[model samples]
Target: MRRPTHLRLLAACAAVAFACSAFAQQPPIERQMSPEQFKAAGLDKLTPGELVQLNAWLNRTVEEETAKAASEAKRKVVNENRGFITFGSNEPIVGRIAGEFRGFGKGRSYTLENGQVWEQVDEARLAGVRKSNPAVRITPSVMGNVWYLAVEGSNTHAKVRRTK
Candidate 1:
């Protein structure tokens, strides 16, 4: 009788192990819930076909929402850093230079009021010029990463690179 009882215990343990493995292979919706919660939600009474359909709908919804969120995040980042980062937009970045503007010189950095910093990359100069808080327009090239920074009320345009 004791031997029969021990055999029954071993069989019950094996059955539990098999059930756990099967549960591990189920969808996230089913795997995430405890047995009590599944029964309480009446999901335990769902047929296998119903469970599959529910999991499929959940997966599609999650993927679509995730994609939308990722796209919105990317758009926000690009909009906020339009001056410093390029996102294939042809619109020129227009802003005022913070503090005094001593004109453009090679290797000089210009800090914009929007907190973007650009360095003059080419040998462009505007001699005998001084202004305070002058507006600037930084235009991108039509087919490349090259950008030109032009000061307001002047024809002088300097080739520039984002430094910060």
Candidate 2:
């Protein structure tokens, strides 16, 4: 469901970066404006050195603002995907199951407090146990996309995949 939104955000960031590079070769504000418009704006009176300084300032400002926007976009994406295993993160996802957590069973779905839903995919069970909002640690396999969900304080783990 969220894959489209992530793609769009990534595309928008790429577009912004491309646009910045397109303007990189022509950073002079005077060139972007017509000669008549420049004179009308009273920029014609500025000395050559003053024009160079102005262009430099404009470039710096654009770079700074673009960097800030990119940083903010990245933060939003990371926050929105708190429960899922993101790229470059090797740590396990730690959170409590949302409600009554029965012992793990194949095909059972578990919802986490961080709004992630995971479903058991393999035959791993912990029978005759129940807990309310139990803390869980979902860790990714060292070599594959496989992830395991383990209730805190237990040695048993269930193979799972994110469903939401």
lDDT of each: 0.79, 0.82
Q: Candidate 1: where are CA atoms >4 Å away?
A: 1-28, 45-53, 76-87, 128-131
- Per-residue lDDT tens digits for candidate 1, residues 41-130, read 999988999998999887777666655655665566565555454579998989999998888899999999998889999999898888
TM-scores of all candidate predictions against the true structure: 0.62, 0.69
Where does the lowest 10-residue lDDT sum fall in candidate 1? 1-10
Identify the leading candidate in terms of lDDT: 2
Residue-wise lDDT of candidate 2 within 1-164, one digit each (tens)? 55765676677668767866765665489988999999999999999999999989988888877677767876666655544535566678889999998898999999999888999999998998889999999988876667899997789999998877
Model 1 sits at a Cα RMSD from the real structure of 18.0
Please give the clash total of every predicted structure, in order: 0, 0
Query: Model 1 TM-score?
Result: 0.62
